[model samples]
Target: MTIAEAPPRLAAAADASLRWYPGGPYDLARTLGPLLRGNSDPSFSVQGGVIWNAFTTAEGPATVRFNPAGGAGLEPWVDVQAWGPGAGAAIESVPRLLGAQDDWHGFDEPAFHATLPRMVREARRRSLALRLPSSGRVVDQLLPIILEQKVTVIEARRAYRYLLHRYGSPAPQAGSLAPAGLVLAPTAAQWLQVPSWEWHRAGVGPQRSATVMRALRSAVALERLAGLPALEAATKMQAIPGIGIWTAAEVVQRTHGCPDSISVGDYHLAAYVGAALTGQRTDDAGMLRLLAPWQGHRQRVVRMIQSSGFRKPTFGPRMTIQDHRRH
Candidate 1:
C-alpha cells in the first residue's frame, strides 16, 4: 500500500499525541520506533511493506495485514487494518500505553530512558513485549498465560503450541497458515467445548483447566471488564476463584496497560529487579522498595530493567512439568 495515503482505518488518542497501526502482528519497532522494541515471531511473514497474518480471537475471525510507516504525514508506521471490528481500538490503545501519548514522568523517565538501550537489546534477545497484545477480549489471553504460570518457559511454549495445533482453527484464508503448521489458539467458546480428554492430551492439569473453564463461563463479562478502573478490573478478575494477583496483573498489564501493575507474584521479576538495582537477589518486598520511587510507572521501570541485559543466575533446578493424566 502507498505510504502517502492514510489507511481507511487508523486510531489516534484523545490528545492526537499518539497514533496506532492496526492489523495483526503489528510492527512494534516501525510503529513505536525507538520507544519500544519488538520481539520477532518467526512464524509470521513479510511481503512488500506489510506483515500479513491472522489473529484468532473469541470475536469470530480477523485477518490482518500490518503496514509499518502507516498514517498520514507520519514517517513512523501507525497500525492499519481493514476488517477486524475491535482491531482499531486495541491497536490505538497500545501506543498510548507505550508512552506515545504522554511525556514520561521525571523519576520514571530518567530510569526508563537511561536504561533503555540495554533493555531493548535484552528484550530483543528474549522477545519480551513490554506492551502485550490485546486482540479483542483478554479472557482467552488469560488461559494461555495461566498455562505458563509457575512453569518452565519451554514447557509453557510447548503446551501452547500443542494445544493450538490440536484444537484451534486454521486461518480463514485458504493456505495462510504459514511456516507450514501454525494454527491459531482455540477461541473462548471453542475452549468451552473442548473434551476432557483433549485437555489431558494437551497436558493441562485440573487446576489450570478448571481455571480456564471458570473464566470462560463469564467471557462476555470479562471482556466488559476492559472499561473498569485498573484495580477494580483486577479485583473483578481475581474474584474468578483461580485468577490471582499475578494472573490478573499479567492480563491487565496488557488490557489496561496500567502503569503500576508490577505483577507482584511473577517468578523471576522480583529477583531480576533486586539484582538490577541492588546487585543482590531480592523478594517481593525488596522489589517494591526498589521500585517505590517510580510509583506511578513501577511496571514501566521493571520493564526497562527486564529489557536490560543483566540476567539472574539460573542455577536452580528447573520446575518439572508433571503429566496429571498419568496421576
Candidate 2:
C-alpha cells in the first residue's frame, strides 16, 4: 500500500486512544529521553513501554501517555492519549512534542557524511529515527534547566524533586499514568511566590532563583517565544542576566527543537566534543572551530556524537555532589 494508505495501528488497549502514523522513521526513546531531566523526575515517567509526560499547557495541566506500536524498528508508529482540561491541545501537540515533525533531509548529504567519523556515521545510520522534540513550553523547560546550572546533577535533581513535591499540582490522570505523587510544574504565578527560604530549602541558591524570578516576571513574553525562530528565542532568553548561552541553548533545544543551538558555554560539552572530534581535549573556541562547518546543523552533529557513545578521557577530580537541604 502507498504510505498514506497504510492501515491504522493501535497504540493502547484503552478506549480514549489516538493513533499516529509517522510514515517515516521515528524512535520514541531517543527523541524524548533528553526531555526527562532524571529518572526520578516527577514530571516524566516511563514504565512497561509507556511514557508518561506531564506538563502545563496554555489551557491547563496535561498528562500525555505515549505507547509505541509495532516493534523496535524503523518507522514505528505511536499511540497517544492525553488527560486533563487541555487534553485536546495536548493530544494535538503529541507529534511536535515527540519529534515526528523533525526533518532530516540535509543531514545525510554527501558532503556532511564525508565529514563524519566512521563511528558517528554508523550512529547516524542506526539512529535515523532520532528527532528533536519541541515541547512548546519554555517555562516547563526553563525551570528545571535553571536548577541544573552550576550544580551537580544529583543536587539539581534533589532540588527539583523537593520543589515539585512542595508546589507542583497533581498532573491530569496522575493515578493512571504517573507515580502516585507525580505532579505538573508550578504555574507562572506560583513560581513567583516561591519564597526565599523555600528556595534555600530546595537547595536552589540565589543566582538561579533570581534568574527564575526574572523569567517568571516576563513569563507571558517568554511563552510567546514558542512562535519565534530558535535563534531569536535564544537571543531573547539571554537578555536576562543569569540566562546565558548554556541556559538558552538548553531551553531552545526542547522548546524549539533547535538544531543549531549548541551550548557554547557548557562545562563539559566543549571538552567532550573536542576530545571526540579531535584527539585532544579543547576549549570552547576549539570546539566551535571543529563544529563550525555544520553551522546550521551543529546541534545535530552534537546529538550524533552523543548517540555514538564516544567518551572523553577523565582524569580530573569530579564535582562533589552536595546536599544543601541539610543546611
Residue lDDT tens for model 1, 50-92: 5544455334544444455534654444444423443444344
Off by over 4 Å in 1: 1-53, 56-59, 70-74, 79-136, 174-182
Candidate 2 overall lDDT versus native: 0.80
lDDT of 2 by residue, 1-327 (tens): 011212244324222346677677767887888898888888888886788887877777787778776755545678777677777678767778887657677877887779877656776887776889899899889999999999888888899898988999888763344556668889889988889999999988888888889989989999999999999999998888899999999999998998889998787888888777776888889998988887888898898778667788994778887666567
| Each prediction's whole-model lDDT (CA) | 0.57, 0.80
Sequence-dependent TM-score of model 1: 0.72
Consecutive 10-residue window with the lowest summed lDDT within model 1:
34-43
User: What is candidate 1's CA lDDT for residue 219?
Assistant: 85
What is the Cα-based lDDT of residue 260 in candidate 1? 77
